[model samples]
Target: MDKLKKNEKWFWGGVVLIELILFYSSSMTYKQQTSVPFLEKYVHGKPLKSSLSQIHFNYGGKEQSIANDGYYHFVEFFIRKGAHFGTYLILAVFLCLALYTYFKKNHFLNVFVPWLMTTGLAAFDEFHQGLTGGRTPSVTDVILDSAGALTGALIVVIITYFVIRHKNVKKV
Candidate 1:
């Protein structure tokens, strides 16, 4: 009935939506999940070719070289990793908000529980990926996801601290 209760419901809804998205994506094959065709149609250009060509690294036990693998694969690699980071970051934020609303008195649990849940979900996601065709699990991805979760949780913590401090100051 109150504003806090409504906000808590919204935050939990966001978490559920994110989980559904992850589940659907995990169910797809690697080829089905690739955004290469879309990128080639709209994003392919000389500037991308030049910039992406400069990037070379080893990922998933393979060399991601533009010259060897082509520009599309090279660009897709970053896009995929960014998606992983961004999705987990949002999930963490929602988790933090929902937990904070429910457990306002337990500040330690509010942060720790979200990080643990995000990390656990990341690991589970990787395991699910292994089940899909043409997809393999990566521990590195789990670490990256966890890092994103940490960043989001810290952002929430910092903002909450400042907002609460400001309110307390105003009351004096």
Candidate 2:
């Protein structure tokens, strides 16, 4: 049993390490971080050029071209926010798992601790981005990341509740 627990710890630790790698890689230059490569070729007229190109927009009965037009910016915004949400989501999930595995009780602690830790990590990530070239830190991103983490943690909590309820039913 101890060996199994140890292995689980290592596995979740690896998941966390991968999330760190993703967070760090995301802090690199804009060109270094490419999201949705498959959509790039089809949407941008070429590969590696989704957020880097100017797009056309129709606004208030007038047509205009902007670096980040309505459609393009919308897509780019989603991509960036999705990345933030996903990375933090994974982090929170693994964190909650690890904490719960270790403690095995205290539901509130298991949930809130992971949320707080993930939120702090998100803030640190933005601070790290500020130190990198071509990257600027934004509090809004931190908020987005926190929301993502909270969502991930909530999902785990819900699943755990169901699993425990099912087990209790079986016992009854």
Candidate 3:
């Protein structure tokens, strides 16, 4: 009974964490009409500057820089494009983890289940946008979101396989 209670707490805690992540990234998203200079240009494509990019994502060394505004706008575009998708991705991960932990089992279903949860998460995420100030949902975004969920699941499958293999090797 105590273990069950502890499991429930952890499960809910993971869901709460997903909500928090969604809230944060969604908040980071710049609305189309906002006064923020770069983001405004990024959304509407007013052709602000040929050289000026909105996002300055620093990959690593100072030498590597992407100055093309298209890439910046693309990044911004994905942020808007991916809001719902991010929700799906995160929820799927948590659900998969919780199920794996609970059954104390793992398999192909570990990957399958997260994608399943993603379906509901994708819907809720879009619905959330309807309630928010300047956000509108898109079907394309949901597609992208589902893509992200699948991608995450694939990664988990790879990692889980390796982990299980290592465990077996250790037992030998």
RMSD per model, one decimal: 2.1, 6.3, 8.7
Clashing pairs in 3: 85-145
Q: Is candidate 2 or candidate 3 better by TM-score?
A: 2
For 1-172, candidate 1 gives per-residue lDDT tens digits of 1355569979999999999999899889988999889888888453568777787888667888889788877778889999999999999999998888765666677688999999999999999989998988999899999999988888887778788779889999
TM-score on alpha carbons, each prediction: 0.90, 0.74, 0.60
Evaluated against the true structure, the overall lDDT of model 2 is 0.72
Tens-place lDDT per residue, model 2, 68-133, is 344444465557778888988888888877766764566777678889988998898788888889
**Segments of candidate 1 deviating more than 4 angstroms:** 1-5, 102-107
* Window of ten residues with lowest summed lDDT in model 3: 57-66
Instruction: Give the local distance difference test score of model 3.
Output: 0.60
In model 1, residue pairs whose N, Cα or C atoms come closer than 3 Å (at least 3 residues apart or on different chains), thus clashing, are none
Q: What are the lDDT scores of the predictions, listed in order? A: 0.86, 0.72, 0.60
What residue runs in model 2 are displaced by over 4 Å at the alpha carbon? 1-7, 34-40, 44-70
Ranking by TM-score: 1, 2, 3
On the 0 to 100 scale, the lDDT of residue 62 in model 2 is 43
Q: Which candidate has the top score in lDDT?
A: 1
lDDT assessment of candidate 1:
0.86
